[model samples]
Target: MLRWLTRSLHRKLTFVLVIATMVPVILLGMVSYHTASTITEEKAKLTGVNTLRQVNAIIETMVLDVENMSVFLIGQQEVQSYLTRERSGASEYLRMIGFLTNLAFSKPYISDIRIIPFNGNAELTNTTILQSTLFQQVDTDPQFWKNNTKWWSPPLTTVTSSGIKQTVSLVRPIRDMNTFKTIGMLSIGIDTAVIAQRLRDAAVDGAVMLVQDAQGRTIAASSTSITPSFVKIVTDKMTNSHETERLNSVGEGEDNQVVITAPVPIVPWDAYLAIPHHTFSAQNRYVLQLTAIAVVLAVVIMACAVGYFVRQVTKPLIRLARHLPAVSLERAYRPLPVESEDEIGTLISSYNLLNENIRQLTEQVKQNEAAKIEADLQALQAQIQPHFLYNTLSSVQWMAWMSSNDQIANMVGALGDFLRFSLNRGMQMCTVQQELEHIRNYLYIQSIRYPDRFTVETYFPDELMGNQMLKLLLQPLVENSIIHGLLKTKADQRGLLTIEAETPEPGWIRLRVCDNGVGMTEMELHALRERLAHYRFDDKAALHAPVGQDTSGCSAQMKPLGGYGLYNVQKRLLLHYGERAQLHVDSKQGAGTVITLYLMSNWTESQLNAS
Candidate 1:
């Protein structure tokens, strides 16, 4: 499942869509639930405080009514006559008890009433005998009866003539109306059940309400199963606090409950509300459940929608992927069908065009290969004719020598040597010495053909002898100078041919072929340089291009080169050595023409072969 989730685009898209939709929804749900929970808790605390306050009011009113009854009985004529007489018959005592009972009945929360005389004697009562232990403490402690202020007794469980009751009483000292002398005590027993019932009526759901006395004893509790720890927590909070009402918490986990307490003004008691924390979060719980449902629904819908859309996109890509192998193998591939007029459709069209271009490029490459072979064969055929001519000339030279014709033999010998070096077994490169030797042979034949008409001078260093250069480089240039320049001069004005070679700087060799003969004008020099600029050795046809017909006006036996010799030298130099090889012509009418060839000096044999 993990691998599929990682590898499948469809699965990944679905997962992302689900996450994208659900994350913010879940986050918002949590925030909203927390916010609602906080508000609900605050409202619950306020409600509990208000309810406790109301409980305080009800219990205070009930206690005040009981205390008011004591004041009313103290002023009663029947009770004053009886106390003054200091002795009462059974009828009078019974009558006083009946009046007290009737008064107790008048106040619903009062269970019993009693009148105690200080003379170690009990007077009429509501059928409950006051225990001597309770009075002994009051008698021994004069402070208990010293004041006329009302007081509340501590919580206790005792048997009354009516029933076993858990209660506390409001106690007041009855004094003489004129003398202000203490006579007896007036006591009214208030049942804790009345206060507990009032607390219960004011409580919220899951809330435990209690009425506890000033001494931290529980008068009554709304919940029968109240924990001791919870009671202690409330007691400690009420003990340490000065506020009338506030919110608090007790215990941990399930035992944890929120407590709110308020003082009861009519008595030394406190009204407490302790609600379990989870109970107050009922509304927030409903919100969280609803929010969870909403998030699930949203994620489900988004996942379905995103999955369908992603399938639409990835299906086309998958089909396109199936064609990749054919492109890799360089095989003919069918074009993808255009499904829409979108970027994908445009992509398919571009791919089809690229495939077409590849086909044309392949055909062009094949044609180029075939043309290369044809040029090689033509070059071989070209070499064969020169070979045959050299053999025929050598035979002619032998015959001339046998016939004792020295001039004919010498001229034919030079011709044979020239042709042998020119062919050079179809090699485009030859040593500088070999090339100079070939040029010397050509000059020898030319000197014989036009003796005394031109004089040849040669100067070169031994260092340059070992340098390799393109074959036939110097021959054509010297030939052009003799036939076109030296021969143009008259016999009385004899021409001079100078061939010089030198190293101008490190890594560079320079050669010059100069003729002190009829030179060309500036216009002709410009036209010739322009013609050389257009020259290319690879295209043999460019050599045959007319560079002005030769006008040397020498003997008709002089061969017609069509003025290609000088241009051929320029083309070969530029082609073999690139631009680094410089060819320049210095000339002026009635002066002389100097042709310079600049080449690198340190090129190796392998480098020359590669060139």
Candidate 2:
């Protein structure tokens, strides 16, 4: 489904445009929302913390007032003697009620007070009904009777004619003023409405207010709207740090809560205000809605633009395609009219330009074909004359033989064989044996010309002579030795040139041409080697096409740009065989020069036999 939606230029472009419009809007909204949310959260935390602290102070002050009142009542000489009395009359009991009533009514936070005596005397109370159930439950309640070191007791639940309610008490054992002995207990019930009202007043929106004892037990929570799981989480997070924390506490299900714990004075109870995380994000709702609206509007705008663009692009091509069936390609191109200066117009102009170039090329191809046919006929006529030269050479040899001149007959035969091998059907590579044979014929002619000027020797093994290599590779080296080395020797010196072939390794061959002629000096050898190194890079080192061939019954030599010497040999070896083929020229001034060519042997037995 996703691939199908993004398959076309229109849909993809729509997505791109919408995203381009929406990214900065969304980013700015997010950054603004985050900054505002942070500031608001801190403010909420401060307000919550301050409210909890004030509520804690109120509870602490109420506890202190109750404790001091209880002490003052117990320490009164008349009340102490009355509480310890073994027999108390109606006047004393009624008078004791007045003392307890005045102490209870002294503080506004004290709702109800009681004095239960161990001695056989009637209990004093402020209410006329004198609820006996409260007395019985307070006497029997397990949690209510727990030992406490603080001046005030932890919050305890009690049942009255009203519904269940929570309250703190200053429940202390009253001591006799004379002996410092404990009497019956005096419990001052703190006003439950006052504490509850305080909790409600401090309650921030979406905050679950709680009152906990010093033992970290939940005494009363102001909110029943909270889930039982969240209440459990708040109670479980007993942070020692006085500051509020985003306590990600308890067992994992919705455990995150912001718990602000403030220590209540005197009693050491803690007042906790737990605000849920959802409440903190209430401020970002407006920003998020605005961003979403902007994205939707951008998407709508993008849809209109992309649809219009795609229609404009595809309409022209559709119109052009409709005309294609009627269009025809003729010898001369007739241009289609350009309707508008858009890409479609350029496309029509390109089509007309291509058709014109194609028409011209068609005419050129026809002319080339005609010229090729005429040249083929001329080539056929020329083919008849090649054998004429061979026939003439054969006739000359026969004439020399008829006249009994064996030297002329032998020379003519050698010349004919040499010319035949040199133009061996235009094959660039020849066998080692055939190449050495060509060299032998050339040396015979040279020996006749300068009989005592030079001497030539050859060493070729039958095993290595059948290997195939580049044709005429050795001829240039031999020619260079004769022309530049051997022919330039001292008059007293008879130049001796040696030609040899060897196999240094399997599948590799080396051909050597050494001459005992006037060798080059150090500087001359350096200059020649530098020229050979840069032969391929030198523009003048390029081998030129021959202008014409000399067909006077002699072997034709092709003069390359750098002359057909060691430079030609180096260039040919590199061009044909790459770096593996090597040409090394070793020479000592006035002593000798050795030119060795190393190339791979690349022919099978059939190829050698064919050569």
Measured by TM-score, the strongest candidate is 1
Query: On residues 405-464, what C-alpha lDDT tens digit does candidate 1 reach at each position?
Result: 999999888878877886687677777789888988888888887878988889989988
Top candidate when judged by lDDT against the true structure: 1
Count steric clashes of candidate 1: 0
The sequence of per-residue lDDT tens digits that candidate 2 reaches over residues 1-611 is 68976665556665676677667756765676677678767777777778877787777777777777777777777767777988889998888888767766777666667777778777776645323344444444334345542245556665544445556666666767767566677777775656766788778887778776766655556765656566667767666544443333234435456777776766656677877666776745675566567656766676677668766766666556555554443445566777889888998778768767777887788899999999999998698665787899999999999999988888898999888887788677789999999999888888777778888889998998777888878888888888778888776779899999889999899899999888888887876676566544334324232322222221233233334566667766665665678898889877889999998897543553343
**Sliding window of 10 residues with minimal summed lDDT for model 1:** 550-559
Count clashes in each candidate, considering only residues at least 3 apart in sequence or on different chains.
Answer: 0, 0
Q: Residue 119's C-alpha lDDT in candidate 2?
A: 83
User: Per-prediction TM-score, please?
Assistant: 0.49, 0.43
- lDDT measured at residue 149 in model 1 versus the true structure, 0 to 100: 74
